[model samples]
Target: MGRKHTPFTSLSRRKRRAKTLHIKNLIYRERDRLGGIFFDECDQVAALASGRWTWSDIIFLSQDPAIFWNAEIITANVAFADAVEDIAFNEAFSKLNAAETQQEMHLDFTPDVSSNGKRWLRKPALKYPQFDGLTFNDFIDKRALEIARDNPPAIYCGYRILPGYASGIGLQIVVEADRLNRAVIETAIADFRARGERNWISDVPARVCYSDKTICTPLKIKE
Candidate 1:
């Protein structure tokens, strides 16, 4: 008989765990220096060559919109955990609170393949003059719709294993927005588990937020 499977031993889960660990380790290294937000706008190649910057230094740029327009925007399917995201935000908030002038801080951090995580899938850079009058959520909604239209429905799983620290698992069901109702998500999860990948399924459907006020999840739909 084939070997019985467990969560940790599963190839996919192990890979996800490795990614989560890497991101956590990066943040932990900068834990002390994380009390402030930082921004950078200089010659990218030259700055990286100077060895004065690192990817962790500017990871927060993922949250900013203006930088997307003025500079190159890189998107990564980062193994996101609440703790990791929270620590980064908390550090930045601390700096913002202590400053007499309320503005974002600037910094230079370079990333190389050495620091690359499984989530960082590089693609062609996208340049936008501005978001126009659309809010960030609006932009994301449009993009999500475009993606749904371009691709067929697919299910992807994500998880974070922190060993003795913390662990999380999530399942993303990608389908048309109209087709993403709670019933559909539940059925997808059921079907997924019926296929013997039940060990990788989260107790609740992964909360996929299309906008601040709108989110889809197994617990309850938020509007």
Candidate 2:
């Protein structure tokens, strides 16, 4: 059996144990550093990246919302006892493990060779940006998304792992957005998981579940 799954909310009786999402050092480039309250956390990031100069740039960038999200890498790992608690798991998780879905419950992370996952697959590692003036937050914002998409080289971030106790699996999704929202992020994660390779991403078996209790999962999303 895979790891026990609890909701990603606070620890609850229904969800005995669930793992939380984590990030190594997510970055936010100005843009009202305090505005991204929707994010899972602001711990890995430093506070100095905001204030006067930061705010100015964010305002300037806002003029063009196309690239608002630069980069952000949230780390994650599979824990058999508490795998289902992750934000990514719960987002599409509930849908993936539906009681009356036409698909199989034990789905594979690896998709066929024609899938995007296969097109952009690589070993686990981060892709740091080389921009001269861009701040750390900017790098995480910009390059992280590029890497997540895997334009050329593939990246295996912690977020892309299954909710199980096993090893040899993981995924990294880079996106643009100073603050990554859990609800939206989870939605995107689920989307990414749906049409990709079965072997490259995380692997685990989960069934639909719902309860009135808070899940025992952390708020953070990356390593």
Task: Please name the candidate that would achieve the greatest TM-score relative to the true structure.
Answer: 1
| TM-score against truth, every candidate | 0.21, 0.20
| lDDT, candidate 2, 1-223, per-residue tens | 9876542332442332112111112223222433332133333233222211111011111111221111223322112112332322233334332442324333324444678556544322222233345533344344434432343222232233233322112334433323333443544445554544232443432221221122122234342
Top candidate (lDDT): 1
Model 2 TM-score (2 dp): 0.20
Cα lDDT listed for each candidate: 0.31, 0.30
- The residue pairs in collision within model 1 are 39-106, 39-107, 53-110, 54-109, 54-110
lDDT of 1: 0.31
